[model samples]
Target: MIVDANVRFEALSALLGTKITSLSGGNPWKAAPALSVDDFFIQLILNKKTSYAEEFFIDEKEFFDPGYDFDFTNLSDSAACMRGNEPYVRPKGWYRMALKVRGKYLDGDAWLGTNGWRSYSVPGEWPVSYHGTGLEGARGIIRTHYKAGDGQQFGRGIYSTPKLNEAEKYCKTFKSKFTGKTYKVIMQNRIKPEKRQIIGNYWLIPVLAGTSAEEEKRIAESSIRPYGVLIKEM
Candidate 1:
């Protein structure tokens, strides 16, 4: 399917939080917390009132097996504790909360199927991490197995990088991998960087699926106009 760059940028921009400046000379970016405030509160309550250790129980067969040293009495006590407090533990509401958030940020016309959701530009299923030595290392990985079909949509995982040059390096490497192919990079506004081991601005880079290598190359090289926020496309 032909994904519209402008439409995708609009959707992604709306979901981004406020941009944060980095002290490390990286691009400004935004971040979505791993857990929302509601989720945090629920976890805090669970930690305070519940004994997670009590939820585990050893099988009688394992306890009796001579090959393994078993603490049968302790296991029994833990199981008993879990059963005794079963009524107090509340059901987790994180999944429901996530669904609500997805609905709020996703486009209205996006298809929400039983297995997953999909829009013209975004995939309901998140992409796997592109594990490599550096941003440019993606070229070697893509050259090995990346495939492009006429109708199949492709998504690149979002990541934070302090340097715009690093992101450009990735773009250059990715484009070279698909030399003579057509693809479109839907660039989004840089978001506040998450204060993690790696600190930088977060950006989503999506390439549209193409029919042929030349078409894919064209798509990859084509410039995307900025939407609500200005973004540099390579």
Candidate 2:
């Protein structure tokens, strides 16, 4: 679920309070302060499930899916405020499959751009405008580590790549873990892989969570940040 972006090495450092020295900037290439999850918000995500489902498996987005969309659950006019292509604002009806998900969070290819900046031009880099995905992409990834299987590509038993035949494979696995779990997930876009296009394809995201510094580094290594401007830009 880690959405790939040119997060300045400092952007995360500011929040985690890790004293990382800058290789290029020398004076801490990271942003001024550390990042804090206190004020951060969660953009939930769930593809339309053919059957009943409480949650959907979040997988890794490839180089074609745009990974910079925003989440708009707390907004007053979430529907209206999120209408059209504003920074972080998705085009109206972009998430047409949003028939279910209870509106807890915006489902599908959502993202996390602080302050809802969704313009073609990003803060540090990112020249292309992020028209969709929204915040569900970011939260979908974070949730995987704590509750569901492993993040994006590390598919345990629950979530997996588009190669799988059934998307609800985890309903039974975790069902026994949590009794009364009478729900299963279905990739509404299954059978016809083209339906997945309704969510866009481009860019990859690598989510980094947990209290382990070593674990976070491991996540960073295997991440395919085709959109990275910091390293590539360097």
Task: Identify the leading candidate in terms of TM-score.
Answer: 2
Write candidate 2's Cα lDDT for 1-234 as tens digits.
122232322222221223222233333213342211111111111121122322222211211123433222233443422211222232222211111122122232222223343334322221112211112332232223213343344321111122112222221111212232221221111111111111122222333333254443333222211121111101
lDDT scores in order: 0.23, 0.23
Cα lDDT for residue 88, model 1?
A: 13
TM-score for each candidate, following the candidate numbering: 0.18, 0.19
Q: On residues 1-234, what C-alpha lDDT tens digit does candidate 1 reach at each position?
A: 222333222222222211111222332222222233222212221112112321112122211112211112122222211111111111111001111222322233122222222222233322111111122333322212222334332343223233333333343212212133332221211121221122222223333343354443332222111111112212
Q: Model 1 segments beyond 4 Å from truth?
A: 1-159, 172-194, 197-234
